[model samples]
Target: MKDSQPELLHLDSDEMTGYPNSPLPVLIYRQVLDTSNAEERADSFEAMFKRHGWPPAWRYHLYDFDHFHSTAHEALGIFRGQARARLGGPHGQETVLKAGDVLVLPAGVGHASVEADDDFCMVGAYPPGQEPEIERGDPAQLAAAQSRVATVALPENAPVGGPLAALWE
Candidate 1:
């Protein structure tokens, strides 16, 4: 194991590559999926994954009244708020994240915050690896736009096999 990485990584992913860029790719927005009337929308995230039969990965949602953002390799920001998105950038674009707002973020999208109320929170998931954030394209007006970045974790209970298992074999 490399001395730079967390020890748990050895037990988790097959290969943990080091990131080589700065100002990582991240996605920022307001809340989109909630439980009030957006229950189905939230469920669709899982359904979409299940229908595709993709491997499980990092998925989490916080009910913080403060702020947060998506850190997946590729994240989607949906609008759950009543208003529309204000901040506009090439990368961390803001939108009135609603219940069903489908955000199609490719790997390396960067953002800073995705705010929702304590009532319902924004949920996000991603496979292993780092999702880099793109700085807000504008520097004059929206300097307050924070850089959005989050590192995705390994899938839950991924069995040891292949290259990861071969290390021992």
Candidate 2:
């Protein structure tokens, strides 16, 4: 597979809610897949993640509230329809994503689905051996979640492209 330059956006911790967002920037790869077939697109995305050592990709719709993964970084490849999402945290930025759009989210980065079409679907993957633990914005779990975020290691490579040295290194 060929490499593509993706747009990068960095988000900081949400001071008001005390949500520890990721230190690593979020990557947005647009038009990664040219085909319109949702199944073909999903297959290609899964294959790409496996090649990058981030396997066990799953298919589902994103949750509708602000949440983060404490233990694993994640990648979302949109295969069907379009949706608006809030990233970083409740106070984070909002962006629209469509079919063929890919998002690479570092562990602890908050994301939620703001709105979506009926056919909206996504393929999500995590780094090998890492299972994502869902953490909603709760003050009680703030300390533990922040600690986990701080210790989560960066993935060896980017989800779609081969390596992330240029952006992640």
Best by TM-score: 2
Tens digits of per-residue lDDT for model 1, 1-169: 0111111111110111212112322223223234455555546555543333222343444222212222334334232333233221222235444554433332222233355544433335444454433332333312223223223432331111112212211
Estimate every model's Cα lDDT from 0 to 1: 0.32, 0.85
lDDT of 2 at 92: 89
Error of 1 at 2 (Å): 47
TM-score for each predicted model, relative to the true structure: 0.37, 0.93
Q: Candidate 1's C-alpha lDDT?
A: 0.32
lDDT of 2 at 51: 83
Candidate 2 error regions (>4 Å): 1-3
Task: State how far residue 116 of model 1 sits from its true place (Å).
Answer: 3.1
